[model samples]
Target: MKPVDDDVLLTEVQFKELFRDQSAIERYMSGPHPLVLGHRVIRDNRFLVKISPDNLTAFKKEYPHDPIVDLLTTPYWFRVHVYYDIVTSEDFVVLTHGKPGISDLPVVRIHSESLFNRFPLRTVGNRTSSRSR
Candidate 1:
């Protein structure tokens, strides 16, 4: 995620005050932080979030560290990872932000690919960092 120069972005002091012991900045600087990095620029690194009625809750719980969630809780902001389209090779992703007007029904969005910009889920030891059904 690109760092913002304006005060509109979260402040370090505010983060410290809010999280107290959180190490978001450190995690962001190191590797592919799930919260900061978006979908991979290629065909593989797409953050494939299969949304459904059952798995949606679990997904949100699992990615509590996701900054997009934080942004959504506030106003005027949300997170969307662009993916690559297989046919046209366009940049896209099903993006959502701000308050939802309805409690049911999911929206349709486009997905495209980026050759260089991507966030492949990391593998730790024997398990994959990505969650899939």
Candidate 2:
């Protein structure tokens, strides 16, 4: 597997601090929107989901009897990470709610970190951080 980026990792303290903002909490509570990430499936075996009209049409053509297609096309809530460069007070207010009609893509916030990005520390223990892990 490819190495995780250090900048993407967040310390436990930083994670807690970020989550403490009321707006951030509100945003998380409001979300779970259907957004796609690069992660593997943990539950359902369904690998790909057809969302757009073209993809949906093709999916139906391939599997006419599959019921999952209907579910995929419908809106659903999905939780996603929202990365930020500098953790500011305003971020809490901006990211607080789910935008209607917005595509359910989860947001992964890539922030600055030393261990992940610094080339000198290449070992997994030295470089791996929790947020990206």
Candidate 3:
């Protein structure tokens, strides 16, 4: 897969649509394998995002000991699995090893949608919403 450029910022609508379907999230979390190799995050102007290995290296050279790099360089194999536990009223996010039968890591559950896809669609549809069905 082509690397996502750091310049991209996901919009609110795009984020919501991706996570709009609770079932889809459940499927992603409980299906046979749902480990995500990479993820996208929003950063301010001071923060530089790099996807290419070479770019990342260059960035590290310029900003030695940058915490953002540490966050960006997290291992892709570390899986953050999302599941809806019937016992709980809301969804949960869990981090686990990509391999099966591995122990799970601490999880941080956030109630938000992916902004990239949701935002652009909104912008595009704003003009056409009334004209189209």
- Which candidate wins on TM-score? 1
* TM-scores for candidates 1 onward, in order: 0.23, 0.21, 0.22
RMSD of each: 18.2, 18.2, 19.1
Q: Which is the leading candidate under lDDT?
A: 3
> Which residue runs of candidate 3 sit more than 4 Å off their true CA positions?
1-50, 76-133
What is the RMSD, in Å, between candidate 1 and the native fold over all Cα? 18.2
Candidate 2 lDDT tens digits, 9-120 = 2223333453455564354234343121122221222122212344446657776765433434334343444444464412221232134234334333345434344466
Off by over 4 Å in 2: 1-39, 42-55, 58-65, 78-88, 93-133
Q: What's the residue-level lDDT of 119 in candidate 3? A: 37
Evaluate model 3: give its TM-score.
0.22
Query: What lDDT does each candidate get?
Result: 0.38, 0.37, 0.39
Question: lDDT tens digits, residues 25-88, model 3?
Answer: 3532343333222334442111122333544555577767744334344433445566664563
